[model samples]
Every structure is written in structure tokens, then in C-alpha cells.
Target chain A: MKKLLAAVLIAIFSISALTSCGQGLSRFSVTYTDVFDTVTVITAYAKSEAVFNKAANAAHDELLRLHKLYDIYNEYDGITNLATLNRLCGESAQPVGKDIEILIKSGLEYAALTDGKLNIAAGNLTCLWHDCIANGTGLPTDEALIKAKEHISYKSVKLENGTLSFDDPKIKLDVGATAKGYAAERAAAVLEENGISDYLINAGGNVVSKGKKPDGEWKIGIQDPAKQTGEYRFIVAVKDKSVVTSGSYERFFEYGGKRYSHIIDLEKLYPSDRYVSVTVLCGSSADGDALSTALFCMSVSDGKALLKQKNAEALWIYENGEYEKTDGFKIYE
Target chain B: MNKKTIADIILVCSVVLIAAVMLIVTTVNKKNGDKFEISVGGRVYGTYSLSEDRTVDVDGLCVVRVKDGAVYMESSTCKGGDCVKHKPISKSGESIICLPNSVVIRVLGETDADAVI
Candidate 1:
């Protein structure tokens, strides 16, 4: 009887382990590593392998499509399309795609929210910086920056009858700041529509996660700004949330033992020295990404208040290794 | 109650345990295989592969390369090798940055690949 009972117990344990298998989750990822940049898409599902492959393929295609549309190197992209059409026709409206329309609307909204700190019509400023950096020169002179600022007005870029056009020929549009977020959002929508409940999509620094991990919640780590390698500053438990981080450390130039990051201050036409990094959590990846950039350029108090107003959350890492969290963030201890 | 019966029971239990463990291990590896890494700038900012070579350019920042089972910041416009200090990233979910350049390097996990809108 004793032997029989042991056998029964073992059998039950084995069956339970099999039944509660958490490892059955299927995952897929595609990496596009190129000379200019790299983008990777990862998907986890309990559905068919074919379905996951199709979803990943679709997401990859969409990413490439957006890259073509927004890449500054491609002068024939949507921005140029609008610029040329506006110059030749003088505000004779041209029909735009839903995605572009949404982006323009969101861009205007963020510009208003940041009081013009997040202007998409600052293409002249972007071009000036690009030109200066390419020529191995520092930021343009104050007079030159002011001249460039003349074309950096979001209000001048008008939208009507499902069309977008710029009033000034000097005015240009660069969606580099927002295109990745929109692409990420679109990829997530594609996965969710295909019945992928458990997945995470990260385009550059913009990340969005949905559904629940088999263990119930997802674990995300915030990078340590001071650490060169092998340590995280914090770990946050997230679920169905999008996390986007913007930091000055990611890109910069050095001069006379000083580091100058690539994030330009539109007002100064120079790199900023505000917060080191800003992480935003919100419902949409695009919002999180855009807000992270905008908030990083603002004061800590102002950033927190902005997150509060948006009903979102943020964590700001300062230069001195100090950090601040918004009221909305339920940071893990 | 003899030695043969006891030995038979032990052998059967061992077989069952091994089979169960193997099933679990296979499933876990399958789930993990879906994850990949994207290295950017001179540092590995977000989640990405440490085993393969990857090159990325972050606009105003310098171009970064990850190759030959190591990660390093090859070049940057930043004053110091702040990004180079990050070395090469081998672990997932690790990152390096050149703050002055606005360049971010990250190592994302497999589950991190899902798109968030």
C-alpha cells in the first residue's frame, strides 16, 4: 500500500507539471541590422507558429515602409512630398494617408503641450544641425540659429481637406522623432488583431507590452546611466504598458573634455544639459516616446506635472545619479 | 518486496522524472529563442544580441558596431569615450550610452520584441 501511494503521488506531480506548463509560450523575432541602424521585432504567442511568423513578417514590412516614408536621406519621402507639393502649388492640398494624418495631428498636439518644445516643423533647425555636424563644425552661430528658427513654426505647416502643406518653402518636416513610435504602435496593433495577447514590441527606445506573462506580470529594467556595463539602476514591474526612455547619453560629441549630446535645444540650437534620461509610461508607444523626449528637455518638476496632466507616469534620472518619479509610477522596491 | 521489485520502481520513477524535465526544458528554450537584440550608437543601449555583429547610427551620434562575440563603442563625436566605457554587451537587457551624443545602446530580451502601440 505504501509503495502504491508513492507511485500515485509521483504520477500526480508529473501530470500537474505538464498541465501547468508555462514554457509552451511561443516566441519569434526578426532583426534588421544595417549600416545606418537596426530594428528588431519580437513576438510571443500561444497560437500557431505560422500565425506568429506572418505577424512578424507583417510588422517587419511595416517598419521598412515607415523608414522609407520618414528617412531624411530619402528626399522623396512624405515630408519632401508635402514640401514639394506645397511649394509648387501654393497650398493646393494633397490627400494624405491615415498614418501621416494621425502623426501630424499628434505632432501639433505635442507641440502645443510642450509649448513648442516638440515642434515637428523644426525641419530647418534639424537640417542646420545635420549640415553642421556633417561638416565637422559645432553648432551654428546664434545669428544663424535665429535665421533657421524663422522656418521652425508648427503653425505654419497647415492641414486641411485631408492634406498637409507648409506655407514657407524654407519650412520642412522631419518626423524622425515620432515615426518609430508610430511604427511600434502599428506593429502592436497588427499583433493584437491577429490574436497575439502576450507580446512586447520595442522600436529603438520605444517599448510597448500587452497582456500578461505566464508568471502574471512583466519585469522591465531601467538602464543605469552612470554604469558603463553590468548593472541596472531600477527594475519596474509592468503589464500592458508602454515604456519609452530618452537620454542625452545615447548620442553626443566631445570638445575640450566636455560631452555634448545630440539632442538639440530648439531655442538655443544646441545640445541640452538638463536631465540625463527620461522614461515615460503611457497607453500608446508614440505618446511615451514623444513625451520622453519632450520631458527630458524640461525641468524635473515640470516633467512630473506634465505626466500627471496626461494621466501618465515618468521617472527622471538626473546627472548626479539622483532620480525622481511621477505620482503615477508604482515603482518596485 | 524483493530487490527486483524495488529496483523496478526506482527505474520507472527516474524515467518519468527525466521525461518531465526534458519536456519543460524544451519548452523553455523554444520560448527563449524568439528574443533578439538591437545594438545602437557606440553602446548597446536596448535589448539585442551579443553573439552577432550589428551596426547602428543614431543621427547626430556616432555609428556603433557589435561583432565577434564582443561589444564596444568604436567611435563617437563625444569628447570622451563615455560610450566606449560600456565595452561590449554580452548579456541581454543591458545598455550603454554616450550622453553627450544622444546615443543609446540597449540589449532587449525575446519577450521584449512584441510591438506596443
Candidate 2:
């Protein structure tokens, strides 16, 4: 009977390790902005704060390393990143790192999965939009967008012998949508492998919660769409989940007193005006990031159709102040 | 002592260890008087106690006010000023972030650092 009681107690403790998993576990948070263009916060739990910091540093450094390798803008010691791949477009297929290779492969998979709604090969359209925003010229001329459509095919990318090649020299690959969240997922794994659980990794809008807080669930706030400035629409109680939010409110530029979002539709060669914000709840941050953007660009029916293949849920805030969410998604009352 | 007694003692020791750990963690993280940390560009810039009210000039671009046990943004350089619109934070782990300036302030309990790099 004593052994039986002890077994039951052990089972209960292991079941809710975070709730009663107290004592000996030190929880702390560290922020790093060495990459991802935005701040990344990872809260960790360990035997000691010093031990937690050391483990957190390892994860942060790994994210920085991935950032340098996956950067599409800057050349770090000429290591041949995505930008280099684009600059060397249509040339001989040069050897690339595994990170770039995996990303390209994932890009291809997501392209097919979302039916080209998420395209990394539409750099021409994205670059033109960037230039338009920088020059404050508002929307690009139809001629420019039409020209950009020519080089917007993901199929033009060629993978051979651990290298990548593009059929169209104008083709460029942009991984902005996937890089940050992918880094978060990777870094979170490092923390878990190091036996550090009960963490929250918020890389910009891409957030991943590993375990519950000692007090209770991790409360994640969904950014309010209607309100220009304030608290979130609602808080979500989550554990072992990834919450990624894509919104047009934060990143926008005004041209002729009209605000334009940065997300562009490859098919229309213009900004997608379907949704103001889309939050994807999934197991992986990479999927959440890409799917949030893809679903934001699609109609609800189409978004729901594609989401059937994956075990992920989505909540969409339409342009007309409407809320649409999957059945599994529940926001705080 | 008998073998059964020794086994019972081992189990008791394990339970005590876990209970002691729980006590340490709860006491260590207990919410103390108001203290908040200010971060710029993802680095800890300063930590201020909220006992006395003061205005913090954040690099001449933004101003933060700590008064009445609550901290809030009084002004900022960003056009959106979302940070300014955010509510004052006094609870532990609450944060206000300004993306344009890359500023983040989080409220925390009074816990000294074990190691600094």
C-alpha cells in the first residue's frame, strides 16, 4: 500500500510538473536582438539562474548563427547566403549551406501546400514594393508590377548537387516570412535538448511556448486589430504550442494618405487585402509563420480547404472588423 | 534499522528535497516592491525602483514615467506611439514594446543577479 501510494504521487507530480514542479527550478528571461531584425525573448527554467543563462546563451547564439547564414540582405564574410544565390542567379550552381538548402526545400513544400499563395521566388514584386515604399511613390505603376510577375515562379528554382540555380536571372528568393520563426523553433529545440523546459520564445510576432508556467498556463495576447493602440483582443492559455501573428497594422506606409500593407499577392501582383491580421496556432513556429501569411492572403474558404491537410488552427481578423476562427481556436471571454 | 525502514527513509528524503525546492523557488520569485527593467535594442539599459517617482529620458527620443508603483511611457519619437498608448505596467512579467525604437520595458520581482557577463 505504501509503494502504491508513492507510485500514485510520482505519477501526479510528473503529470503536472510545472504546477508543483516548483523548488530547485529557476525561471528567468533573456532577450536577444542580434538577428531577426526584431527582438527575441526566451524565458527559461533551470536549476540555477546562472545555468539558465548559460543554456539561454547557447540558444541565442545558435539563432544568431542561423540568422547570418539565412540573411538575404547582408553578406557576412561572403559566406554565400540567399542574397548571394540571387546575385548569382542563372549562373553555375554553387555549393550552398544545409540551412539554405533546407529552407529552399521548405519554401518549395509550402508553395505547393498553399498553392503558390506563399512564394519566396516573388522577390521582384517584393523588391519593387520595397522601392516604392522607400521612394514614397505609393503603389508601383502597373507596368512595373506586370514585369515583376514574369519572374515570380517558384518552379524556376533548380536544386542539384547540394547547390541551387535559378532559370531566370531576375529571380530572387526571400525568406523573411520563414526565417525568424524557423530560428525560434530551432532555438527552442536547443533549450529542450539541454533539459531546460518551461520557456517562451517570442521572436517578433512568432511565439512558441514550451511548457506551462509554474503558476499556471502561459497567457499569450493576440494583438487587437480594431484598436489603434491598447491591449490585445484576448489572452490565450497555451502550453507546448506556437502562436504566430501576421498583421498589416504594424508594417505599413502611407501614399496619398492611404496606408498600404507590405504583404503582396504573387498572383495579383499587388498587396493582399483579404485580412488585416491572421494568427496561426500550430506545433511548429515555421509552419505557423508561413501559414499565417498564406491564410492572410486567401479567402476563408480557400484557407480552410488548405488547412484541412495540416493539424493547425487559424484565427483571421478580416479587413472589415470581423473575426473568423477555426473550431479548435478559443479566445478568452 | 530494518530494510523496510531504510526504504521508507529514502522516500521521505526525496519528498523533503522536492518540498524544499518548491519553498526556495516561491520565496525567490516573490513579488517585492515595484522594480522595472528597461531594455533598448534588446539589451538591458537600466533597472529602476518605483518607490520614488522620476522621469527617464530614453536617449532623447522617448520619455518613461515611473510613479505610484506603475511605469508608463509619457512620450516617444515614433509616429505611431503605440508604446505610449499601452497601459502602465506594475505586475511582474508585464512589458511594453516600441518596435520603431526597439525599446522594451518589463516589470520584475526584486531578484539580484547570480552571475553577469
lDDT of 1 at A197: 82
Q: How high is the DockQ of candidate 1?
A: 0.12
Worst 10 residues of 2 chain B by lDDT: B108-117
Q: lDDT for each of the candidates?
A: 0.67, 0.77
Models 1 onward score TM values of 0.72, 0.80
Residue A46 displacement in candidate 2 (angstroms): 1.9
**True-vs-predicted CA distance for residue A216, candidate 2, Å:** 3.2
Tell me, by lDDT, which candidate is best.
2
Distance (Å) between predicted and true CA of B92, model 1? 4.6
TM-score of model number 2: 0.80
